[model samples]
Target: MTTTFGATSTTDEVLQGVDLSGKRVLVTGVSAGLGVETARTLAAHGAKVVGAARDLAKAERATSEARAGAANGGSLELIELDLASLKSVRACADALVADGRPFDVVIANAGVMRTPFGHTEDGFETQFGTNHLGHFVFVNRIASLIAPGGRLVNVSSAGHRYSDVDLDDPNFERTPYEPMVSYGRSKTANILFAVEFDRRHKSRGVRATALHPGGIPTELARHMEPGEIERMLEQINAQAATEGQPPFQWKTVSQGSATSVWAAFVGQADEVGGRYCENCHVSSVTDGTIGIISEGVRRYALDPEHAKALWAKSEEMVGERF
Candidate 1:
């Protein structure tokens, strides 16, 4: 029988009865929102959690909040990591490696959303660069230290359903860039990256998963205009109210993070790899539709040929290898 979890399930619900003592977890974007919630829940259950954030100060604040909520939150550490730059990624990884700690779970939870056109330190499109390639490079740097039987959870988004990866001109080199398109492209890459990484690394006891955290009114969308946010909420509310079905909707932060927590510790997910999930199950892929189809992965996202090509191109672009 296939079991399904929902957007309303909290991390505590997903982690109930799970023992994570002695396990080491690294969570990015842990300063606030879903990332903080994910970290707090994991640590409360006994996992040694290192909360990495772009801002150390904010991370410290998050740590205090997490500690207040966790029975075993002493393990939470705030590490500096800026996903917008390779240099920053390397520095963070180097420090972690220096600590000589092995991580049992690496949650790529940090990401940027729809924002005006911008570029990274390497001059790539901002949303695509930080949300995808930045994490890509950092994952490679830390792959060796990831526990052999560890899980790598890449927090992707359903916005991926908005568009597929653009190979011809990913960086808007030849074409004009659109904010939403760039966000969608990056989310798509997050899925494909997991597919390829799991394919290559599962043999070594490393598995990767990509998942949509469900729609939540997270700070990631802070860059968008107020009207844009309202419009989005209106659309989701309208869709849900009209459908009477589950709203196909956005979840609260705890609810949004439940699936990722489940994926990290669920017994059923232990050997599962290279799949995209939402609402705590393998997400259904619907063609030209906003709703899920109920089974199988996205064709373009899992295209082995494209995965390999993207891997190669990414390596060349970052001058790094896994």
Candidate 2:
């Protein structure tokens, strides 16, 4: 077993002594929460960080906050990117490519949870469309700009444990869309996307990994009802109330961002592609005591056949290839 960093591990803890000098990292959803923390930590470690967000104003604010928190070698740049729109993703990629600056890490940390039933401008369900399909196209379009040994960290969630992929009705066209199920499908897609991406690109010096950032009290909860949030916490506490139980808990933004930053800059993950990570470590594949995964890849998430099929279907939907 590898060193296990718990959900309390801070971003700086995971990145301690991991110098990213001269590395270029693009971090999406940097307007707040774990994304902002991840970007800040990377920048602090000497990476040239590009912060992507839907709103320029919010992006600027995030950059300012990061700068105020910068240590040695900290640098940040803001860029416009709305994952909800394929056109926006393409344009952002084009801009970066045209600039001739290569990225060493692309952290797909931005996502929406439990969005109402709707479709992207490209006509796909909101969660599957924005969270998975948008990122699908983004990664492919920007593949050339990702340098050898580069990392692509898809920031999935433990909520993925809730469900698996629905191949027949991925877009909910044939079936009614339930928010949680749609979110689960998209999260599952995030991991599979990494698995297939690594298979295709690892030899080219690019690697992809997916991560569950652990539960955090982040902006992600803004969409949930207050009662729902209370219920969620009550449920967690209820589980922890058992004798000899470790406390069921939530992470702060820094803690939640740790695994992602670790995947990006830690040497342990180098040459190790397509693994699912959490709590600043590679998560265990087995069902464990109290059902908490300590650290290996989930079999279902790593199913290569499913990944390939999803890739083809995604390309058909996006109207392009890597």
Candidate 3:
């Protein structure tokens, strides 16, 4: 059946009439926003949702609603994961693997947005290290634990349109550092990670994809200066106006998280595997300088050669081969 959903669809709407009994999902960033919403929907629909976060107390508080509303054998569990640190990432992955319970879906949703320049515990650029490399090491480490026909959903962003991954200088050592540039490179890496992961695992009945949750006013923007988001919205709206399009509207948490649910469960595996998605469907490739207002994936983000190169580079950086 063709999907009846669009940009305005909510998680509740997307999961309507669906039963997730026996499904097991792991969602990162469960402390707030899209992660909580995604886990809530999955658990409410009878799926066992394992939530990972850096802050256990915060996550326990944040996921109370999901735990309270859980139904039909559905439940939520929490595990500590500090994606900013390689030691933490590996430990988390190792513990999960040792448990031997297979996950039906793994959503790499935790990430940092535009922030003042810094490096992670491992000394990589903060955004790239936390958002991309961390998950890269974690997921690939536990890849064997994903059940056949499982899905890996990497939560990327529309900001990927801002730049492609610079394999030569991933740490901004030689180039000027812009917040969005780093964010873009990281988000693009998220997509490329999915592309290559899907390629390697699809033959085993595992499919991976990346998606943008649309713009939502969540804690992801806490690092931004006051008025930064507002100014960006104005610019987006101005660009939309010039293009004869509706003004850019921020998505509610539900609306923002709908696509993740769609891609994880509702969408066809064949259609979405190895693709970049937004607005509840696979995105078409497009070229533009509309900032984040552009509505499609860049071709380079899904290039097979690029994805392969990234995979190799990632292995080298992490000092581990998948």
Candidate 4:
């Protein structure tokens, strides 16, 4: 079904000839990077986009080019959202619900990366709290605003293979906090959130899925120590050399975000629902922590029982049941 799209495909390339004139979409993290590119391309193709960002001023500046280029009755509206804070997430969700606008898709695209040991405003671990729990409560609270036959696209990562959710210590109270470890837990949680969410909402034709936007150099790595990213690329390239695979080639923001829009609007609903996707297609369940870097969803990331457990844990942490 996605024969024409692959790792190198850009958002504009994937959405070519596809009309989105009447669609309304919600995209979080629109202050920069793939989020802005995703919103831009969608609006250029004629969808109304509600762009949410923790810093509205930053978002407005970033989206200036997008607003100027929009066509086909497309438009963009900025909204304030801070995923790390439940109060902010809830306030945003309540505002959207009050507006009574139905979204064709809700893209929980905002997240933090390997931050140093810290806690959110709610005292939860920064990575897990911001990347997973924050979106968890935010999406669940606004679940009804998604129109039937809609989609929820969680921007996850291949980093999930680094670790699985530690339900007992989601906040890393006992476990030693390494940035990637926490990031992995949070990313894995993203996939599992989609797994359970799809099961709960697919019957109503609203399907949930997660995707790994291939390795890209984005502001998401703002938390990394200086030169840490360069070290990572060297390591990845070294690994690829041993495996006879191509070395790392950074994806442009457009290419990285293609899979997100593809999964949200083009991929087959039944095939992608509750599944993890990458490279513009349904990812194979590799079922393990591979040695070298590569593509594939980890088996643990899609486990149904684990998904259910995470849902319970998230509800407990957020103090809200969906």
Candidate 5:
């Protein structure tokens, strides 16, 4: 029987009856928000979860609550990871590889939201570099360690509707940089990366998927100025008006994490892989337009050709091949 979980479902609810004993899972951005809840839920189900973050001390503190709540044989470990730095990504990947532990699931759940225009240490646009490229390099470097039947879940966003990747000017070198636009491009890249990664790796029994973890008031918005936040709320209300729907509601962290946990553990790879999920199910494809409160994914975000192109571009930018 198919169990349908909804947007309000919590991680524990979505994972009901699921057994994760002996499962080795990796979750990024576990310092707070949805990441913390995701790791806690997985660990509470007997999964040995490694939580990766930019700050080990912060992660330890943030996840201490999770460790206290662990059930069965569940456990949490912290590892240092700074997605904006290529050197850090490489080192993290190398450390995981050296550990010689195969992972059943890898959730790239950490990300930066709309921020002032800036560049990563590698000189790429900050959002794109940290959100997409960092995970791209990390995943590719550690791809071999994913056990057969393993899953990769990229935590994307509905904000992808705001813009698609600008292949030629990804760094905003020629075009003017808009913070939300850059964020949209990066989120779109997250879905596209999953698409291509699934296409290429499915033959090896590894599947990939992406999802929008719903709108939650998390530290992800810490960088947004008050004016930007107001502007975003105005856009959301305007979009809601057009859709004839209620204004967007903020999801609790548990609700925001349900889809990622569900995608990681509850479904068949062949069925869920390469799809974009929201509200705990595969999302429909919609016209690519800017609508912050829209329900479906944009067509361009799921384009296989764009996925392949992004893969190539990512390889070039990272100075490596997957």
Candidate 6:
């Protein structure tokens, strides 16, 4: 039976009665925010979690706290990964491959939000590079290492409604870059990646899903300027007005991670695979009248043709085949 876990459901609440012993999970951006709660709660449920971060020192300290909160024989380890650097992404993937320990789930949870124009070390736009391409390459390299019936969860955002991927100029070579637009494109890519990945790998017993972890005030918003924040709030409030709904409310860290954790371990593979989830369930496709932080996936974000096209363009950009 499907349980309707809501916006306020905490990680522990969603995971109650779940036993993760012998489950191997990988979580990115575990140094802080939702990543920490995700890793910690899974570990608490007895999953062995490999927490990836750009800074080993910071991750070490963070995982120590995660370890303290773990129950049912849960534990966490640190791995170095700088998604803004393709070289680092490869290195981290290589390290995991060499370890040869198959994963039960891989959570592509690391991402940057609205940021000023900049390029990654690989010369892609910062948000797209780090959020989508980085995870793209990482997942391609490690796809074979996920155990049968395993999952790949990409932590996307509701912002995907803001824009769709412009395959011709994803890096803004021809168009002007707007921080939120770029972030939206990246998020859209995240969902498409999961869609295509599931199509290609489901026969091999690996399922892929993407999700919006709810609106939580976290470090991911550190890049937003005050004016940008104000503008975004205005947009959200305006959208809410038209929808005849209340303004959005921010979730706590544990609540923010509930959907992701549920996607990873709670639902049936066929039920969750290739779907964009929020509030711990598969979201319906809706028009943009929904508030910025509201629950729903956009039709464009789940288009099969778009998913396949993105897979091809991503292969060209990363210079690797999956």
| The candidate that achieves the highest lDDT relative to the unseen native structure | 3
Per-candidate Cα lDDT values, in order, are 0.81, 0.81, 0.93, 0.92, 0.92, 0.92
Residues forming the 10-long window of minimal summed lDDT in candidate 4? 287-296
Per residue, candidate 4 scores C-alpha lDDT tens digits across 87-180 of: 9999999989899989999999999999999999999999999999999988998899899999999999998988999999988889988999
Q: Could you tally the backbone clashes for each prediction?
A: 1, 4, 0, 0, 0, 1
Model 3 alpha-carbon miss at residue 116, Å: 1.3
Candidate closer to the true structure by lDDT (higher is better), 3 or 4: 3
Look at candidate 6 and give me any clashing residue pairs: 44-71
Q: Model 4's lDDT to the true fold? A: 0.92
Candidate 5 CA-lDDT value: 0.92
List the candidate 1 regions with Cα displacement exceeding 4 Å.
1-4, 72-74, 236-249, 291-297
Give the per-residue lDDT of model 2 (tens digit) for 105-205.
Answer: 99999999988899888888999998999889887888888898788999987666656788778889888778887888899899999989988888988
TM-score for each model: 0.92, 0.92, 0.98, 0.97, 0.97, 0.97
lDDT of 1 by residue, 37-58 (tens): 9988888898888888999888
Residue 306 of model 5: what lDDT?
Answer: 94
Candidate 3 per-residue lDDT, tens place, 154-241, comes to 9999989888999999999999999998999999999999999999999999999999999898999998888988898888888888
Candidate 6 global TM-score? 0.97
- lDDT minimum window of 10 residues, candidate 6: 287-296
Point to the candidate with the largest TM-score.
3
Which is better, 1 or 5, measured by lDDT?
5
